[model samples]
Target: MDEFNGTEINFHCMYIPFCDARDCDRELYDSPVDCPDCNRGMVALHFTILILMAIFITMGNLGIILVIKRNKIFHNSFNMFKCSLAFADLLVGVLVVPSGAYETASIMMRSFDPTALNRTDYLIGKDVAMIRPDSMCDRIYQEDIGGPGMFLSMISVLSVMASIFHLVLLSIDRFLAVWCPIKYNQRKALKDKCAISMIIFVWLVSITLSVVIPMSLGQRHFIHGLSPAMIFTLKTSNPSTGIFYATFGLGLPYLALLGLNTATGSIILIKHRNLVRRSSLSPSLNSGGRRKDEVKATITILVMIVVFTLSTLPAMVAVTFYNGTEHKKKGDATIRSIIYSTLILLLVSNSAWNFIIYSWRNDNFRKALKNLFTRKQQRQRAIIRWKQLKCSVLLLSEEKRRRKKLIKLTEASNSYSSEKM
Candidate 1:
């Protein structure tokens, strides 16, 4: 990473000590990058991680939605925003995860016969081109499918961007509730409508910024590897656009999230401390307890926003900094596979694991999820038992009919024999 922009060329390729039986150990006598075992193993590991993350995200967010829907405790503006985040994450699971697995497998299986670092591209003593272009690199990951691919890519961008924007909205919600309590309560009747409106507004803004703007005015990017759909900028040889997108698109938003969170937190803590100091009784009294609970909830939500945003930062940085050089395109297949896959996994992880956080932080959510699942399991069991009992009754009735038929047949046979005699 230190020499990421350096002019020095590294010919090294990562390799295992030996190919395992899982990949049949039939690696060609080529470079490590050309080893089928590496490709297979990489695909298996990456695909598993992506699929697992996808499942967790789908089920977890769905659980959050169900818990919120059924449990009246979470039926507020605050939890509505949480639901918005959950919905955005659901898109990531439904759209981005499968794409990531496909992209990873494609990238892993792809290898160039001859390294692209040759002098034909004229990258001699001069620095290798830092920005990788879609034109130069093979479109192994979701670019070749034409209309559907582009549509999926747009949705992918929308998903991640919507998640981030929802977090920002959460911060703003916290800021308003903490810093302006009187107004916040006065607007209580409108909060639900406002929250819904804000949710729609946030998604609109995300689509505009991530999809519309990019489509209208392209920004060159390095590598996005088709996961989390966190980024959708196209690439060119121009380096400045990538830098600009990274700075304004991701960096500024990240800093703003921090600023809003920090300011809101500081105000809440300071006010709480002052109240505690001035109060005649301990902060555990009814009034103080309510205040503490509100503060705790605010802080918890803020922590969630911070963590969700922070989880995506490293991946954004990693993808933004990846070079689009021919050498990077071909020579660093294995390296890129690991780095891009891990970064993509990081991107989707927050969306996937938010339910755990919800369960851990809020008792209501935990109890709700538990009750929902438990009740569902009980219902499923009851249905199965009912089905079994019905089948058993059916079998008993069938046996009785057979016995009656056998007796009738014997009586008829005896009558015929007596008549004949």
Candidate 2:
């Protein structure tokens, strides 16, 4: 079946470029698409990896959500953004990833039969349906409208967008807090209520873009050379949807994150430098204390930004370039499946690493997580968590005191004027 002309083409042959003929002795490749990577042992290994990664991602983020909920220290407005991001990341781990991983693994498992490495019914679009005769991909393609499948499709894009938006929100919050602390505090826009409002806005926008109408009707165009397992996410036939998602959904927000985080980091560094200058001149000043906390937080954010970019951008770029049933037809299953699935593993790796990042960089998060594992030493852990978090609380309380003092002075002046009258 490995045929280009009426005659059968040998799998080991190289194409003679000028002669326009494929031979085993020639330099150019004709046999490379046979997928040396899709051997049973390799597919099984990667399959195991996907499953394990999914489990870790699900459990890790779930722990983060629980720790944030149980601990009072994490209830601060900025930490609430972290909570929202964790929840969105959790949804990706739970709803979007596991099933897709299973589908991908199934595809890989049967990709190259030991009996027939050369004979092929698949690797071409016309016989693509034979890749899975009993697959629900058929049902999905037929508009069978299974609720779970449809929901999964929606959530694949949905959770990622929400996660990205939440990260953007965190960056914006950090930028505001660092670049103009006075203005940031005066507006009270990122107070608990405002944080809740913004979180709700993120989910709403993600739903509208990824699920509500665009994916509501399930207008899917299957991509050739890529498996249905991989195609399930971002399933749309609309050029407009793809274009808009590429431009706005994936593009602008990531750009915004880069700009905001860069600016925020630069500001924090400047402030730290100034504090160091002042501390050197006046040894009595405690100007260096909060700078450590700010720097740590900034570093955590930068780490997350880097992880998000590295994990996600490759998948987006690959899927964008090699999209649709018409695209990548010349390529064999080996290149398509291996590279795409590997990129997906990288993408989901983002969900798994947040707990590690927080634990490494953040003491409050570590303390809260430790509290979940043991019941003893409650008071010590509480003190530790409170110490880590109370600086921001003290600053907020100090501002409230100033506002109250201003209001009292105004009231006294008005009362004195009334008495004089």
Candidate 3:
């Protein structure tokens, strides 16, 4: 059976250079034909948008990293959350962006030559590509597909999970800092480090589930008969898959952050409000700027929550509802293009907007940024002044020497005249 299947698999793979099989039957399928309009304009659009996103995200996240690393003032508990969020976004760009680009390219490439895709072979000949879940033949042949699509999808999922998990930690940190001030002040650094470690653990666990388990042993699919001839496509589907992801990656963390942010942030706001009321009513009137700083911090934290939610929720919604739509095979390009553009914009924006949100909304962050830029400007001005001074000094010294030389020449000429006389 192995020898016969191996011969059959080679025949199927002959058309697809990238196809390989580990646990799939190869003899039952034929080579697929090209997909005329599968990826079409969408692939180009996806690539363009992805490339631009990669560039924009890289630059923006780097700015956030620099701001945190370079400035001590931006290293507070809440600001630390901002930095961690930025770092997570940066990791997404670093680890997942290229794979996203590749996935887009692969879909586009397969559209052009669907039958020639080696990834398509595992998809077509085996039980991998079909969307149906009940067939025992499909059920029994679960371990057949392995390729870049699966790998990239796994990493992308991992990045998303990390982003969500870190956001939760960030929200919790802000919550604690606001609602539990005494505790926050006492053990801020140790708590922050521990939170960071927990974030790392989140990523480690997420990667294990998202990437490692599925690749090691999961059912894969191959799309058949989408083109002029039989064509292969790769995918995976399980009833529990979406639920599992939603529960662990999306649903749980989202609720955790939202609940904590709302509860703790509100408590802080109310307490501070009462304090302000008392201060305003007091006879001494020496409360200074305490109320104002407190109010500003509250507003800043609120804005952070709002911005984070707005930037990320849309993509999550899209992901959640992705399996619901019954898109046509022919319209794959259009659908993917639209979805990809929107999703990438949202995801990338989450990373890109943190700096502006933090700087504009939080007084501490704003002041830190102002001081940084001011110092930079002052240094530049000092350099310019030094350069001007050096040039002026050189010019004046040269002029003095010229005057001395002329005087000596005049004396020499006088001496020569006297000798002649």
Index of the highest-lDDT prediction: 2
lDDT of 2 at 250: 76
RMSD of each: 12.6, 14.2, 11.4
lDDT tens digits, residue span 8-104, model 3: 2200111111111112222332211123222235435545666776777777677777768777766665566567667767865665565545533
List lDDT for all candidates, in order: 0.60, 0.61, 0.52
Task: For candidate 1, write residues 131-189 as lDDT tens digits.
Answer: 11111122333242345455555666677677777777777777777787767756663
RMSD of 1: 12.6
Which of the two candidates, 1 or 2, achieves a greater lDDT against the reference?
A: 2
C-alpha TM-score for every candidate: 0.67, 0.67, 0.60
Judge candidate 1 at residue 339 and give its lDDT: 63
The TM-score of candidate 2 is 0.67
lDDT of 2 by residue, 183-280 (tens): 55565646778878988988898888877765444434312112232324553445776777777787888889989988988898787678678765
Off by over 4 Å in 2: 1-43, 101-146, 180-189, 220-231, 276-286, 323-332, 375-421
- Better model by TM-score, 2 or 3? 2
